[model samples]
Target: MTTPAPEFNKKLGFINAFTAATLMGFVGFFARHIDAQGDFIAFSRMMCGAILFFGILAYKGRIKELLAYKLSIPMILSGFFMGNCLSAYITATQHTSIANAVFFIYIGPIISTLLAVIFLKEKMKPATWFALVAVFIGMMMISGLMSVGPNGLSFGMEFSQETFFGDMMGLYSGVGYGLFLFLGRYRTEVPGDVRAFWNFVFALAGITILFIFTKPTISQMTSTDWMWWIGIGIVCGFGALGTCTIATRHLKAAEFACVSYWECVVAALFVGLLFYGEPLSSGQMIGGALIIIGGMSEVVISMLGKSLKKTDKQADAMGAL
Candidate 1:
C-alpha cells in the first residue's frame, strides 16, 4: 500500500487519536461499576481484545502479519507497558475517584514527551507546548488538585491510607503508559491491525504471567459482568488500540501526546453524566473545557500557520513576477 502524504497522514492520525481516546473513556464505566478486581478487569480486556484482533486479522487475510511480526525488546516492552498501565489504572479506579485516576494516568504524556526528546529526538512546536500546559493545568483542576493539601505547594495531591495504594498505582500507570507510547514508534511500519494484534497478545501474555505468580480467587461473574466485559474489550481494547495504532503510526509520540488528553476529558464527562455522584466541582467543568480546547488548539494553529506561510510565499512570487 502506498503511504499517505506526510501532512495528510498527520491530520488523519490526530483525528483518529482523538476518536480512539474518546472511545477509551468508556472503560471507566466498566471499571467503576464492575465488581471484579483490577487483575480480572485487565485480564478480560486483553484476552478478549486479542481474540477479536486475531479473528479480524484472519478474516482480512492478514494473519501473516501477526506471524511475521518480529519480537524485539521494544515490541515486548511496549506490550508489557500497556499491560501494566491498564491493570494499574483500573485498580486505581477500583478505589479512587475516576477524575483522580484519569488525572494521574494522563501524566503519561509528560513522560512520553520527555522520552521523545531524549530517545526519539523529537521536538515540539511552541503551540503544542502551550496546549500541553493548558491541558495539564486543566487536568489538575479536574482532579481537585486546586484544593490545598498537606503541602503548601499547588500539587494538591495528598494521600490517605485508603487511597494511597490506588493513587500509587495510577502514578505508576503513567510511567508504564509513557513507555508504551515511546515504544509504539518502533512498530509504525506494521499495519495498524497487525500492530494492535501484537499489542493485545503481548499484553494478555504479560498479565497472565503476573496472575500465575499471584493467584487470585475468582468471583462469580454475573451475566451482566460478562456482557460488560466483552463490550469493554471490543470498544476500549480492540477499538481504542486499533485507532491508537493509526495515530501513533503517523505522529511522533510527543506530537500526539498532548492531544491524547481527550481521553481524560471524555472520562470525566462519563463520570459527571453517568455517575453524577462522583465528587465534582465547577473546577472540573473548566478543566474539561480546557482539555478539549487544548487538544484542538494545536491542530488549528498548525493549519493556520501553514496557510499563512503559503499565502506569504504566493505574495512574494506574485511581486517577483
Candidate 2:
C-alpha cells in the first residue's frame, strides 16, 4: 500500500514557506564562494540532493511510494522547469551583476500569477493584484533600476551590451521558475519527498547531458568547496525545496505568492553586508519594507477571509439549531 500523505496545516505551511524562501537567498553565497563553474555547482547540488532524498525514501521504507507514483504531465513539466530554473539561476549569478540577476529572477511570481489565472482559472482578487504590484516595485528598487541619488530618485537603467546574455539567462530562470510553481500547484497529491526526489533526479540527469555539448572546463574544487556543496545540498536543495513543495500543497496561490519574495530581501542583505561591505541603500531598505508589507497583507487578507467564513458557518449552524 502507498504511504498516505500528511494532512496540511496552515501554520506549519506558512513556517515552512518562509524557511524555504529564506534558504533560497543563500544561493549567491555559494556561487560567490565556490570555485567551480555554475553547471558543475548545479550538478553537485543536484547529485548530492538526489542521493540524500533517495536515502530518505529508502530509510523510511517509502521507496515504494516514489516508484508507484504516476508521472503526470504536470509533474514532468514541473521537474523539467525546476531543473532549468536552478541551473540558469546559478549561472546568471556568475555572469551578470547580482542585482540584475536577482531582479530578473524575482519576477517569477508575476509569471506564476499569470499562469495560474490563465490555466487554473484562479480568481485574481484585488488583494492579489496589489501584492503583485508591490512586489514588482520592491524588486525594481532593490535591483537598483530606480536608485535614490543625492539629488533625488532616479529612473532608467543604463543598459550595457556586456551583460545581455546573463540578463536573458536570468529572465529565462524567472520564466522557468514560474512554470515550475504553476505545475507544482497541481501535483498536490504527490508526497513532498517523492516530488523532491524526482526533481533532483531529473535535474542531475539533464545537466549531465548538457555538459556533453558545452564541455566547459570545470575548475578543481577544494575540500572546502566539496564541504559547501554537501551542506548546501542538504540545506538549500533538500530543506528549501522540500518545504517549498509542502508550502505549495498547503498555501493557495494568492496567499503565498508575495510571501516568497522574502528571498529578495534576504539575498540583498547577505550579498551587500557580508561579501561586498556595502551598506543597505535607502532604496533597498524601502524596497525591503514594501516586500514585507506586501507579503503580510496577503497573509492577513487570507486569514481574515477564512475567519469570516468560519464565523458565518457558526452563525448558520446556530440559526438551524
Which is the leading candidate under TM-score?
Answer: 2
Q: Across residues 165-226, which tens digit of lDDT does each residue of candidate 2 receive? A: 88888998999888878888886777777887887777777777768875756468788877
lDDT of residue 211 for candidate 2: 83
| Candidate whose lDDT is highest | 2
Q: Any runs in candidate 2 off by more than 4 Å, and if so which?
A: 1-8, 150-152, 216-219, 274-276
Alpha carbon lDDT of residue 247, candidate 1? 82
The CA-based lDDT of model 1 is what? 0.77
How much lDDT does each candidate structure score? 0.77, 0.77
C-alpha TM-score for every candidate: 0.85, 0.89
- True-structure lDDT of candidate 2: 0.77
Ten consecutive residues with minimal summed lDDT in candidate 1? Answer: 147-156
